[model samples]
Target: MVFSWRKRKPRNGDKKVHNMELEIPRHFICPIALDLMKDPVTLSSGITYDRESIEKWLEDGNFTCPVTNQVLRSFDQIPNHSLRKMIQDWCVENRSHGIERIPTPRIPVSSAEVSEILFSITDSRRRLDRCGCLDSVHKIKKWGLESERNRRCVVANGAAGVIAAAFDAFAGDSFEKNAHAHLLEEMLCVMYWMFPLAQEAQIYLGSQASLRCMVWFLKSKDISVKQNSITVLKELLCCDQQYGEHLAAIDGVNRILFKFIKNPISPSITKASLMVIFHTVSSSNEKTKAEFVEMGLVSLLLESIIESEKSYCERALGVIDKLLETKQGREFATDNALSMPVLVKKILRISELATEYSVSAIWKLSKYEERVLMEALQVGAFQKLLLLIQVGCSDETKEKATELLKLLNPYRPGLECIDSLDFKDIKRSF
Candidate 1:
């Protein structure tokens, strides 16, 4: 008997197309190798087609199902083994062709690429600004960021390059209305972001131009510009020894800072000025230190140390340390009757306030072999030193105390008085 193909139908109220009792022939089954259909194209009731899978089978030259020997026109059909081998060989040949060199189509640079580059540069600048990384500024210098052609004036250019160009452009040109306000703002921003860049760049570019711009900004009506200007000025001077002389000679720089120290309107401005003084005094050469003393900086710094706002006290103390480094400075302090007792008392107060730097400065000042130590001891500075040593807050204070003790003869009549006081007997009497 000949087998006949029969179409299956759903019975009444039956949702399934194939009856439960009758097993569907495996030949009519869709190959599990094919993934679930995304865009299924129907072929017939017993068969459904996936265009890609059918195309693959056709490409393989297999027209029959291996299971049922049925011609494969739809998804239900599977290819015979021999035909599959032929398709595999063809695929291998096509893959080999693909592996061989083929010219890829050239594509033009898209707007997206330009936008990405711009965003990358801007983002990098912002990150560098936030992080205050000096190296990132250098990297930006080496790797120039893409700039918009016509809109170059609108957007600020290279991080450091912008400042360099602006300084060059505005060189010898008095502050003019024609100058790009945005560029000026960007220059200030760059200074604010990485101050060392502008400072170092100033060495290559002369100091006059940068100094002029900074001075102008310092006097600007805008408070932020003034603050940033002071910050830049401080950084510029703080960069290295080469800029020191130029900084000291700059008109209004010292006067303006002294004025701020005398009466500051803003805390930030006051702090910046103190920092400028601290760095200037701390890092100056002997000649510069003498110049500072000649300018009455020593008096102002000492005054600031004693009576300025609490914020400036530490910096003022640092300045004192630097000032005391010179014989001239020691004589000045001594002539002013800044006795060891006075200094030790001040240090003790500072230490009580937890100002370690002040303590350290005092410790350093106490190290001067000839005058400071002798004068300090003459005024009963040892009592305060012993007080600090007893408290034991710092190794330095202890060491200084020990050294100062060794320098004095405990058997000396005056020294014997302190040694004679017995703490236990005094406590018992009390």
Candidate 2:
């Protein structure tokens, strides 16, 4: 039963034998690929498949047999060398039938190779060995995606330090100017795959040079690089509170982050940038509020709330409320043309946190910028406030809304004090 896999037309003058068809044996076909087994390997479930197919399946977080639908005892893929040889022999014997012999696959990277690359990366004298180190790092990153074992090998061999060095070398005079930008983007790609790294790795990657490189990537023409950089920053900066000011002082950091709020490539990217901003403003003071105002963060956040998801709007509103704690933040929100309308719209519209922050922002504006009170009322905010009172809210939101309503129209004849309202029977009309 010789297996056949290809075809050629019979000669015109040949006898009926010339048109005879060659048939393929069913056993030679891989169950997963439905084709002749090239590099055949058997799983614990005793089913054979092409090695690449089964390895990919296991690495994708699957723990069961694709064929038997049973829980796999182990993920080990033992090479079916005898079956592969038989398939190869069949191809050889059927050469006249147009079957092509399959070539052997390359062996995947081993822990030894990864360790060698790790040593090459950290050796101070090897700074001039940039291309080779980068190629090695790139290969490890490729192999890391192939299996859980390879990922562990790559990380155990100090992948974090190598990536950090790669970025640092990019900033220094290691690569030529033309190729420098190219490698910087590549380094970021590697970082993207290695997210949520070990705490020690995060500290090593938080070097001043690495920090600057990541901030620079926020403006990258490649959206992927920008997103990866922001994610990396969030992972590193959020882990340690002491690095907050260091991130804040990076040139163009605030401006670039604010820009992402208005021109985000995706919700995830915007969320990442917002998280970085939140970390940067953790312990911020009046000077920090003024800096954000100068960078137009207030307007960007106000605009963000209009179309962002619930979580995004909540974060933006929370940041805005924090900014309002300072005089500069209040003035910026009051003066921006769309800020009042956007903030007022968020009241009783989005999530509870958004409504809380929106009411707080309005309270601050009414308290400090007395001139903007009527504008808040004109945007239907008074109705939302009445709704807040009618339906009820958190004790704090209820108190703040009560204060704001008094400031808006002090002498309303029928208005009830927040303390006297019974929340259980309250109705929300609007």
Candidate 3:
């Protein structure tokens, strides 16, 4: 209800008593809100307001009461429990009106409570007792669910770093198939809750043991565990390109990443895996990029772009552009059955970023090989490039489109669709 304030006598700071237009009692309403107060708390100035409303007032750097305009001696607000009970009773009496009862407010989690919980997590991690780890982490999950503040509290207390230390210990023997995997999943779930992690958390996650930990988790048959692992790895790789490069260099790590994309667990997981792929290729040496291509990443990339949701599709385009940077990558794309059509299909149909990456991928393909220009034309790359230029795109992408048009426009179609020819095809031809 809107309050129309007329000048009032000296009371609290300009207390605007409710403009009695409604059928509600003035004392039943918060003075500041001019409406029924849920969870009323009396300030030092003898003014009561909805806790949320006053908290916001305080948060806005206002030290004075909205009603009294009197400066607060202290910011403490005492819960007006009597007023709350009266409000609840009134709401029940007026249930026929549209009034719904406000549920009892939860006391927000405190730093001390969070500290005790973190201590339990630390103790549980150190001991490696599955039952203890489960109990502690369950408490954390409960605390986190109570409010965003609790999540911040958990992160502030280095929950992620502690979990990473636990994960690191588990990685040393992840292949043993013990209770560590289940406990690791619990730890990972909690850590994943606080992504864009605190610095202390990132420090532990960026270590070598965490890399090995990630590799083992990717092999997890449990989809939830694997998805969480992929997502966390995606962020970690982004933080340090070296992490991506290092992961790519690890034994069978690239294979696991490639395999994740190949199998297609979920859209989010797929996009994350694509990012991990792009980061690894972009940050690594030429040999590392080539090794990924040789391991059959290019075909899966094409499949991803084709089958993907918007997120996966965009990431797949980025990986493709990164892949074409190396000779091995280019050769694989040129020979892959889906490369030409996938590049052509994405040019105008996807988002601008997708168009940019698609144009760049095609440019790398046709620019280097020149012979691939024939295949691009046959797959209608020439027409897509022409459309892209005429409409809109980034300046660099537009320029590449123009260049490809200049090259492919001169080429006639049906110049032998050799894009599908792999090493076996070439061997047969020879």
Q: Choose the strongest candidate by lDDT.
A: 3
lDDT of 3 by residue, 1-430 (tens): 4333333443457665433322677787877677878779899998889987887788789999998899999988788888888888887886544457777766656667877876776786676656776787778888888877578767777777776766666555443565466766777787778888666666677677777777778887888888888889888877777777778767888888777778777777878888888888888888878877887888877876676666677888898899899888888888887888788777656578888888899889988887688878777676566656666667888888888888887786445333333212221110
Poorest 10 consecutive residues by lDDT, candidate 2: 415-424
The model with the greater TM-score, 1 or 2, is 2
Candidate 1, residues 293-366, lDDT tens digits: the string is: 56666666665565454556666666666777777776566556543434544544543432344445455555
> By TM-score, is 2 or 3 better?
3
**Better candidate by lDDT, 2 or 3:** 3
What TM-score number comes out for model 2?
0.64
Residue 355, candidate 2: alpha-carbon lDDT:
88
CA lDDT, candidate 2, residue 272: 80
TM-score, ranked from best to worst? 3, 2, 1
RMSD of each: 21.4, 8.3, 10.3
Over 4 Å off in model 1, which ranges? 1-161, 168-186, 193-208, 219-223, 236-242, 249-252, 307-310, 338-342, 348-380, 387-402, 408-430
